[model samples]
Every structure is written in structure tokens, then in C-alpha cells.
Target chain A: MGSFVQWLIESMFLWKALIIIVIFAITLAIAAYSTWGERKVAAYIQDRRGPNRAGWGGLLQPLADAGKMFFKEDFIPAQADKWLFILGPCLSMFTALMSSAVVPFGSSFIIGGKEVFVQAIEINIGILYVFGVVSLGVYGVMIGGWASNNKFSLLGAIRAASQNISYELAMGMSIIAILMMSGTLSVREIVLQQHGGNWNIFYQPLGFLIFTICAFAECNRTPFDLPECETELVGGYHTEYSSMKLGFYLFAEYINMFASSAVTACLFFGGYNYPGMDFVERQLISGFGANAGHNVATLIGIGSMFTKILFGIFFFMWVRWTVPRFRYDQLMNLGWKGLIPLAVGNLIITAVAILSGYKLVGIWVGLALMVILISIVWSLRPKKKNAIMGA
Target chain B: MQNILNLPPIWYTFAILSVLTLFGALGTIMSKNPVHSVIYLIVTFFSISAHYILLNAQFLAAVNIIVYAGAIMVLFLFVIMFLNMKEEADEMKNNKLVTAAIVTALLLGGILIIFLRRAGKEKVDALGFNSQTGMVEILGQSLYGEYLLPFELISVLFLVAMAGAVMLAKREQGERHF
Candidate 1:
């Protein structure tokens, strides 16, 4: 027991534990409030005043929403599998929350002459850890759909399962290009490598594009949200769910969005690395001494990281509202035929470029390849029948 | 009490995980519903992955969950759901089949026991248990260096299997050959 306590103290300081709890709470709060953000964004886009009744500009809207969910009568279908019906949302929320553990929000800062890494956990295989959990999240959708005992729900769940699995291949392949360039799997290491404005986006812009698109598909966002298309499958897998159980599914999606955005920022954009950060750091160190300046720099990094995450979320919302959902066939074709082949080609080009010691040229090559591929896909795409000249 | 307290946390975790894995495996075999069986199998895989974590094989642990619990079990669930399998009735019991099952179980147990006995005779890897063993870099180096041929061969095997699966699933134009 003493040894365990000693180990815990050594491995995780009181400050670290507090930071983790704070981050966890913040993540949940963000996910809860993101619903409000989404509605507000949608309303703004559609030209309306969105939910301003709960508080000043609907600041307390999420709380009211939570309360409503709590007060609402919970309903379960008569033929539903009780165990799996409950397990579904719990699994979704659990996996969604777990994926955030690997993300590095900021660089290390000195506290009591010891360096503290500002993230929940530091694992060597951080990227893979997130991928594994995200992949596991599909089970929640599958189980929920199956347990619902509704045909629509079942179809939606199967579609979601296949969709997530298919997109994950492209996502993983695209990430391979980033991994090759960064030469590390640890999220912190990747972020650190991107310090002083050497963000991975510059080197692997094409990879980033592929990753972002695949992320949308993986998250079941925007044009890729065929699984739960309201015009077809009514509420999709959550058709039978009511009250907090339903809330959990929605909340899980938001959390997944937040986590994936953070992951993208960490992978592509400079995670916490701001441009001219070294110059600022040096100036600050000379002006205000080392430790204090370092603390300030760390704060700035955290701020920058959050900014990137917010923008990423905004991009998700913007795309969601702007782009119409793809047909089911188009979704599969884009994933399997479009992204996978492009990702593989990009990865091969990256490898060859690395081998030949022409890393900068590799980025241009990747961009050219992506453009060519897109054009090829565009030309080959089955043309939509003209409305005036009926097919 | 002092000795119990002095034991490392990993031992306690290992004991709990081992028991859980065994229970999950039993449930997998004993569950009447195919979906329930698949879920139990997933639980078993998860516990085994927990064991992998305890052994400091973090990469293996993650891969195990991703491959077994995530992908493979999902496919299993999909199949069971697609079939819409219900609880099976006890029928078509044959003496020969029962005898064959018993013999197979006995043989498997004997082989497992022999392997365990042989393993027990060797020195433990405790002295060589470096935390870095599980890092992606080390794993990649070893896999690409010493295990390159085997890895390539396995990838080729997977490609073949995938092609076979695609072919099997493909619809035939000429008379719908089974």
C-alpha cells in the first residue's frame, strides 16, 4: 500500500491529477454547451434568434436542456434488449471520454522545479490509442441499433458500423503519411516537433486534407451523415431511446467532435506551437526572467491550442450546414475508391520523398497527386440527370 | 496484512483480470444467444488486453482491443444481427459428436498443461522487462528487422484472404453458382 501510494505520488503529482480532473470536466462542459453552439450556429445561418430564454443569450441553455432530459419520461421499446439498450450509450460516452486522455493541450511548464506535461496521460502510442477507442465507439452504435428492435434502427446501425470501419482505413492510411514525416506516434512528441511554426500542415498538407475528410466520415458528420439521415432512417439508431439515454448519444457525438478536432490540431496544425513562438519566448525570457516567461509561454500555447480546436469545431459546423448529405453509394465510393487510393498514393510518395531526401518537394508532389486524383474522380463521377432535360 | 499490502498493484490487477477473463470465456461458451456469446467474447478479449497492459505490452494491448473487440467482434455481431438468431432448442444430440467434443477438449487440455509445465521450468523475464519494449519505435525496429519476412508473408496472406472473401461475396451472372 505504501509502495502504491509512493508510486502514485511519483508518477502523478497533485497538480497533474487536478489538471486531469479539470480537463475532464471542461471536456464534458464543452460537449454539453456545443449543442447550444450548434443550434445557435444553425439558427444564425437560417436567420433566426436561437434559444435566448434560458439565460442571457442562452448561456444557461445546456443546464435547462439537461434538466429537461432528466424530467422527461424514459421509454424503452417493448421488444428491446434491456441490457444492450442501456449499455449502448454508456459505451459510447465511455469511449468518447477515454480518447481525450492522449491529447496534449500544451507543452510542459516548471512547477516546483519539476517539469509537468499538460495532458491527462503520456503514452508512447497516443495516436493508436485514440484510433483504437474511436474504432470501439462503433460497438455502441451497433448495439443500440440492434437493441432497438426497429428495422430503421438496425439499418442505420449497420450503415454506421460499415461507414466507420470503411473510413477508418483511409483515416489510418492518411495518418501514416503524417507519422512518417513526424517519425513518432506520441502526440506530445508530434506537437513538440511542430514547435516554432514547423507545423505538420506545411509538410503534409495533402495528408491533412485526407485526414480531415476521413475524420468527418469517421465522426459521421456533415455530408457523410447518411447513417442517421432524417429523410430516410427516423432518428437512426436512437429511434427507440428517450430522455438521458438519448442525451448520452448526442453528448457522445459532441465529445467525439471535440476530441477529433483536438487530435487534428495536434496532428496537422501546430498543436500548441504558435508562429514566432521562439522569438517571443526569447524576448520574454530576457525581459521577465526565465521561469515566469516560460509559464506565460505555456499559457499562450494552451490558448492557441484551444483556438485551433474552436476553429476546427466551427469548420465542422460550417460544413454540416453548408454541404448536403451524400447518397449512400457516393459515401462508400468516396471512402473506398477515392480516399483510400489517394491516401496510399500519398503515403508511397511521402516514403519515396523521405528516402530521396527531398522532403519539401514531397509536399508539392502530394498536392499535385491529390489534385489529379480529385479531377479524375470528378470526371468519372456518374453525372446527375439535368432537371430540364429529363433522363 | 503487511505482506498483502506490500504486494505490487500489478499482481492484484492481474488476479482480477485473470478471473474476469475466465468468467467471460465461460459466459461466451454458455450463453444461449449468439449476440450474447459475441459480447462475452469481447469481454474476454478486453480482459486479455488488460493483461497485456499489465505486462507492459501497451502496443499489443491496444492492437488486441482494436482488432478483436473493435473490428472482429463487431463483424461477429453484425453477422448474428443479420441472421437474427434466436435461442437454439436442444435437439439433434449425437453420441459420436459428444465423444468427439470430449476427446478434443481432453487433448487440448493435455497440450496446454504440458506447455505450462515447460514454461514454469524456464526463468522469468522479470530481469529483462524493460518499459521501452512496448514503444512503437522498438516494436517497429524488431518487427521490420528480424520479423520482416514473416510480416510480409502475413500481409500477403491477408491480401489473399481478402480477395477470396470479396470473390465469395460477389454475385455471379451465370446461373448463380453457390
Candidate 2:
């Protein structure tokens, strides 16, 4: 069996296809289980016993959930756009899967006297591929909302559109800070940029904060889940959907969660890097077995990345349970009135810093500007006496 | 079969693209509804974009999808839903619409066939793009360097569109007062 595996690895085309399939399966499976994890996290946070009955510590809960969703009845409302209703989820799932194509899982390792890379597909516009894919995520919600033949669904879709559009601006702007610091848009390059103790969180702490907040808003997690506000919209855009159709929406959300977490890990948390990673590999592992176990080092890099992603996922769940959901108007107000201006300011600061060669001073100045802006916003708010009188 | 699959990359892509193009254009017209038409148009755009990707004109394809499908189709859907014009009216001259669509389809198909025939005579590119990069850097460099005028013009065009939309949606004060 080991020899067969070795032979399979030696064949390039066969190995490529196998690797692609494995990556797809692993990503999708992680996304699937994240849904169960989210529920368990929420339950634990709320002081309730979680899904312990499915398997040992509810290890098989996600499988049971998938089974339940599959067995449930599928329905198409008489007035719904049947074609679009189908197309919506397909778009969501397709775009959700597309962005992972360019991410480098690990550094290259030697195979058959030649170096072999572990990335799925290396493209020059790696990050732009992500931008494109993320933009397409909007279509799923928009189409699903429009096809539901219900007012609530339409409203939910509209909210999703407006919220996404608003946040994408800030999100893009937040990215400018990273792009300036890293000097490249390639995810692998960005990871390489943070190879040491100099993770981007040190250089661009405010940018990290802004980007993390924007990530929440972009993924439509609480306190930004205005699109799926249960109290007002009655299940929001998926109100009329049942069975796998409903499962598709929920599944897409989880995939989106994973994807966003992956992006966050890549951008702010040094991607697949840890402090002293190279030092440890060079000093200790390089000598072991005449460096024959190089794959082990690569494995460590890959595992570090996945660990960061897992932490990101946990953070998403933690925030979801801890923070109350934003009201619709407040969501809009925060997105447009607050984040947009701040993002634009952040972009200007980043640009000026890059061009002016005032690395430390420029950043501190930017931070001060951000503080002033926030203080101005606070000062502009109505006093309690005036607010009470007006009310 | 293996040899066919292993054909030179350009020709392989070209053959598949031609088939997809034919199917897409055919499906666009043959479809009964505007929704279907738009969806088919998206597929057509995507196939064309893939062809662009093959040719290493990645920028053009990205713009093609972003402008035509992403921006334009959404507006089309908005208008259709707003007007609630989901289906053709029974009282309408169905033959007229059908004939008009058919004639246009035929004319387009004929032109494309002629173009394909001519293109077949030209030297096929067996190699050119070796390293693939996203179009953004290339497009950005070109736009700011050689194509600066056109880039500025596009910005102006966007501004004009914004102004036009505002003007069209605006409530006339004269009418309101009256």
C-alpha cells in the first residue's frame, strides 16, 4: 500500500488531480463541520448541553445534521422563479469553492530530484481572484431573495446587497494597508512577508481591527446579520426554501465563514507562519536525517496555517455568541457613515506612508488621525438631556 | 481519445470554446424567457471570457464579466422585476417577435461563421503566454502608462452615468409645486 502511494505520488498528472480533489473535499468538509461547531459553540456559550447524543461529544453531529437536511421535504413555491432559485445556491457554492484554488497550503518540497509545489493553482492575481469570488457571493443572496416570491425575502436580499456593497469598500480599503506593507497581492507572498516575528498585526494593528470588523460585516455574522434578522424577516431570504435548498443557504454561510476566516488568517495572522519557524527548521530539523525529513517542516507550516484558521473560526463563533446583532439602520449607519470614512482615511495614511518613507512616524500619525476621527464622532452625538427632550 | 484530450493547448481550448459559443448563442435566442436569455448570455460571456483567459488577455475577460454580466444583468433583472414583465402577453403579435429574433439570430450566426472561417486561415498561436498572471497589474500599468487618456475617459464616463441616474431619478420641483 505504501509503495502504491509512492508510485501514485511520482505520477505528475495523477498526483495533480488527486491533490485537487483532496483539497476540495477537505475544504468542503471543514466548512460542513463548522456549522456544527458554530451551534455547539453557541450552545456552550448559552450554558446549555450541546449535541452530545450524536456521537462521542457529538463528533458526528454534522453528519446527522446533513442527513436531516437531505431527508426533509423540498418545496418550490408556485410563484417562485424555479430556475433562479436553483441557480442562486449553485452560484453561492461555486464561488465559495473558487477562491481556495490559488492558496498555497505549504512551501515547496523536493520530489524525484526536482522541487514540487503544494499550492493548488498559482495565479498572479491570487488576491484579486478572492475579490472576484467574494463579489459573486452577493449573487446567491440576491437571487434567492428575489426568487422567494415574498416581501420579506426581497427586503432581506436588498439589505444584504446594501450591506455587502457598503462593507466591500471598507474591506478593500483595509486591504490597502496590508498591500502596502507586504508590497504584493499574492497570498503566498503575503505569508512570506510575515515569516518572522513581524506579523502584520504589529505594523497595522488598526488596519487589523478594521479588517476584522469588516470581515464580520462582509460574512453577515452578528452583529452584522441584518439580512437574516429572524425577528423581522421571518427566516429572511430563505423563508420559502425547504430541505437541501435551505441547507444550501446555511451551508453557503458556513463556507463563507471558513473562507473569510482563511482570508483573515492569511492577512493579519501571518498566514502559515509562526515566529522562529525558519530558525527552528534551519537549526534543528535541517540536520536530522541529512534533511531527509524536509516534508515534516512543510507539514509544520501547513499545520500552523490551519491552526490559525481554526482560531479564526473559533473567534467568529465567539463573537457571534457574545455580541448582540446590530439593528438594520445602525448596521447601515456604521457601515456607511463610520467605516467608509475611516477606511478612506486609512488608505490615504497607508499611501502617504508608503511614498513618504516615514514608516514608524507615518503609522503613529495615522493612528492619531483615527483617534481624532472617532472622538469627533462621539462628540457629535446628542447629549442625554437633549435626546430625552427630543424624544 | 487520449491524443484528442492531449491536443495542443490552443487548439484544444479553441475547439471547446467554439462549441460552447455556438451552444450559448443558440440557447440565448432559443430560450423562451428573458430570465433564461440573460442566464444564457452570462454563459456566453463566460465562454468568451475563458477564451480571453486562454489568449492571456485576462483583463478583458474580467472586465467583460464585471461590466456585462455583473453590472448589466443585475440592472436588467431589476427592470424586469420592477415592470413585472415575466412572460410575453398572449395578445401580442407573437410571430413578429419570433421572426425578428430569428432573423437577428441567423444574421449573427452567419457573421460568426464567416469570421471563424477567416480565422481558421490565420496562423494559430501555439505558444505565447508561458507564465500566467492576473490582469490587474498589466491593466493598471497599461492604463496609467499608454492608455491614460482612455482610463481618464472611463472615469469621466462613470461620473456622467452617475449624474444621469441622479437626473433621471430626481423629482422635478416644478411638477411638485404645481
Candidate 3:
């Protein structure tokens, strides 16, 4: 026990442990409040006053929500497997939190004469790690739905599993383009490579579009939320769940949205990087001390990263409210036929451009090709049958 | 007692992983429910992936989780759920079948033990833990350079299998479209 404590102290494990707790708590808090945010966003979109009765701007609404969940009776269906019934939500929350371990939130800051990276863990294969954990998110839904012992729940789970499988392919292909361009799998390395004004969105715009659409599908957001569409499945996978277990499933969705948004910001946007920040840091250092300048830069970087994440979340909500849910077949069709081919084409173009040393021109060429392909698909779509309409 | 305390961490990890892997594999066949069996199989895969991580095969560990536990096992569960195989059908257990199962299991175990013993004899000098072994760059180099022909052939084989599956699953013109 003494030796173990000594090793822990020598490795500075306490700092990392503290960071993990902070990140996990912040993630859960954001996920909880996102429900309120969603409701407010929906109300604003519909031109109505939103939740404001709890506290100032309904800031205390999430607390009230949690209180209600805790007070509600925890339930398990009579015929359900009790253990798996409980394991579902736990798995959901676990996988949702696992993906954030490798995400870099800000630039390195000096503390006690040592540089500290603003990530829970700096794994070598950061992008792959995220993909692996996110892919496991399907199990929570599948197990939960199956254990519910309801036909609707089982159907919803099956649909979710297949949807995840379909979309992950395109998402992975889109990321492959960025991987080729960045030439690294580490999220921190990707962000550092995109420092200043060299965000990947500029170079891989088509890939970013494909990735964003796939991200929406993977998160079960609007246009791909057939699994839980209220009109069809009636709460879908969580139809039989009640109390905190139900809360866990819903909270997991918001957490997934948050994590995927952070990942998108890190991959496509400049993660924790702002234009002219280096110059600002240099001037600040010349005027003040080195540590103060670095602290300022790191603070601004963290703020910028959070801003990007919040905006991404808002965009997800906005799209959810605006666009209607897709038909199940249409969702699959879009994933397999539309996004996969586009991602493959984008990847090929990116590779060719890299090979030919015309990287900037390559993006433009990719855009042109996508536009042409869209037009071709649009024109080739079968026209409505006039005779049936007339009859 | 001192040696036990001084033992490296990976040995403990390996012990735990081996136990978990064995339990999962046994549970997979012992479970009555097909869904439970698939879940057990997933557990087995996870323990194996953990073992890979302990061996510093990070790439293999991630791929193992993503492809096997995440994708393939999910599909297995989906099929079982779709077919609504909630409980296993009761069949008469013959003594012959039971004996055959036991003999087959023992034979497999024996083969595994033989391989394990031979592995110790033919063991190459094990390299110390190095970050380079797990990086994508080195893995890619070996895969593309030393194993390129086998890799391409395996991909082609997968392509053929995919085409075969598609051909077998396609509906005929007379069939009702879902």
C-alpha cells in the first residue's frame, strides 16, 4: 500500500484524477441542462415563451428535473431481465463518458514549472479511441430495448443498431480523408496541425459535410431519429423504462451530442486555436511575464473551444427542430447510397490531390465534383407517375 | 510473498483477463438464451482486447473492440432479436451428444496446452515495452511492406464474400418488396 501510494504521488496521478472528475462532472452537468436548452430552443423556434418558472431564465430547471427523476418510482417490467434492465442505462452513460478521455480541451498550460495538457489522457490513437467507444454506444440501446420485453422496444433497438452500423462506415471514411491530410491520429496533433488559420474545413470541405451528416446520424439527431420517433415507436427503446433509468438514456443522448460536437470541432474546426493568438501571446509575454501570457492564451483557447462546442450543440438542436424525422428506409438509403459514395469520392480526391501536390485546388475540384454528382442524382430521380396522380 | 508484491502489473492483469475470458467462453455455450450467448461472446472478445492492450498492441485492441464487439456481436444480437428467439428450444440431450461435446472440448484444450508449451520453447527474445510498437506508423509499415501480398489477398477474399452475401440476399422479381 505504501509503495502504491508512492508511485501514485510520483506520477502526479492526483492531478489527472482531479481532471477526470472535473471533466466528468462538467459533462454530466451540461447534459442535464441541455434538456432545458432544447426546450427553450424549441420554444424560441416556435415563437413562444419557454420554461422560466423555476429560476432566472429557468436556470434551476435541470435541478428540478433531476429531483423529479429521483422522486419517481424506479420500475422494471415483470417479465424483463432485471439485471440487464439496469445494465442498459449504465452502459449508455459509461460509453458516453469514455470517448471524452482523449479530447484536448485547450492548449498546454504551465503549472509548477511543468506543462500540462488539457486532456484526461493523451493516447496515441485518439481518433480511433473515440470511434471505438462511440461504436460501443449501440449496445446500451440494444440491451435496454431487448430487456424491456416489449416489441416496440426491440424494434427500436434493432433499428438503432443497424442505423449505427450503416452510418459509422461513412463517418469512418470521411475521417479517413482528414487522417490522410493531417497525417496523424492524435486529436491534439490534429488540432496543433490546424493552428492559426489552417482549419481542416478549408481543405476537406466535402469530407467535413459528409462527416457532419454522419455525426448527426450517429447521434440519432433529427432526420435520423427513426429509432425513437414518437409518432411510431412511442418513446421507442425507453418506452418501458421509468425514473432514473429513463433519465440515463435521455441524458446519454445529450452527452453523445456534446462529445460528438467536441470531436467535430477538434477534427474539422481549429480546436482550442484562434487566429492571431500566437502574436497576442508574444506581445503579452513581452509586456508581462511568460506564465501570465500562456495562461491568457490557454484561457482564451478553452473559451474558444467551449464556444465552438456550444454552437455545435445549438446547431444540432436547431436542425432537430427544423427538419422532420426521416423514414427508416430513407435513412438507410441516405447513409449507404448517398454519404458512403460521397465519402469515398472525397477520400479518393484528397488522396490524389496529396499525391499531385495541388492540395488547395483539390478541394475546389472536390466541391465541383460533388456539385456535379448532386445535379446528376437530382436529375436522375424518377419523376412522379402522372397517370396515378390523374386517376 | 515479497516476489508476489514485486511482480509486474501486467502479470496480474493477464491473470484477471484470462479468468474473465475463460468464464465468458464457458458462459457463451452454457447460456440457454441465444441473446445471452451473444453477450457472453462479446465479453470474451472484450477480455481478449484487454489482453491485447496489456501486450501493447493498441491498434489490435481498438480494432478488436470496434469490429468484433461493436459491430459483429451487435449483428448477432440483432438477428437473435429479429427472429424472436427469446428462449432456447428444448431438445432431448443424448448421452452420445454430451460425450462428443465433452471430448471435443477436451481435445481443443489439449491442443491449446500443447501450443502454449511449444510457444515457451520457441519463444524469441521478448522486447521491452516500447511506444513505437503500437503506433500506426510502424504497424502500417510492416503491414504494407512485409505483409502486403497476404493483406491484399485477404481483402480480395473479403470482397468476394461480400459479393456472395449480396447475391444470396437479393430478392427475386416475384418476391414482395418490403
Q: Give each prediction's root-mean-square deviation over alpha carbons.
A: 3.1, 5.0, 2.7
- Give a tens-digit lDDT track for model 2, residues A182-236: 7676888887877876677776777788788888887778889888899999988
State TM-scores per candidate.
0.93, 0.83, 0.94
B80-151: candidate 3 lDDT, tens digit per residue:
889976555654467787788899999999999999999989865558645568768899999999999999
Better of 1 and 2 by TM-score: 1
The superposed Cα distance between candidate 2 and the true structure at residue B153, in angstroms, equals 4.8
Query: A-chain TM-score per prediction?
Result: 0.93, 0.91, 0.95
* lDDT against true structure, model 2: 0.78
- Give the higher-lDDT candidate: 1 or 3: 3
Return the TM-score for candidate 3, rounded to 2 decimals. 0.94
Give the TM-score comparing model 1 with the true structure, all chains together. Answer: 0.93
Candidate 3, superposed: residue stretches over 4 Å from native? A1-9, A373-391, B90-114, B127-131
Docking class of predicted structure 1: medium
Residue B164 lDDT in candidate 1: 100
- Order of all candidates by lDDT, from best down to worst? 3, 1, 2
Question: Over 4 Å off in model 1, which ranges?
Answer: A1-11, A369-391, B1-6, B87-107, B128-131, B174-178
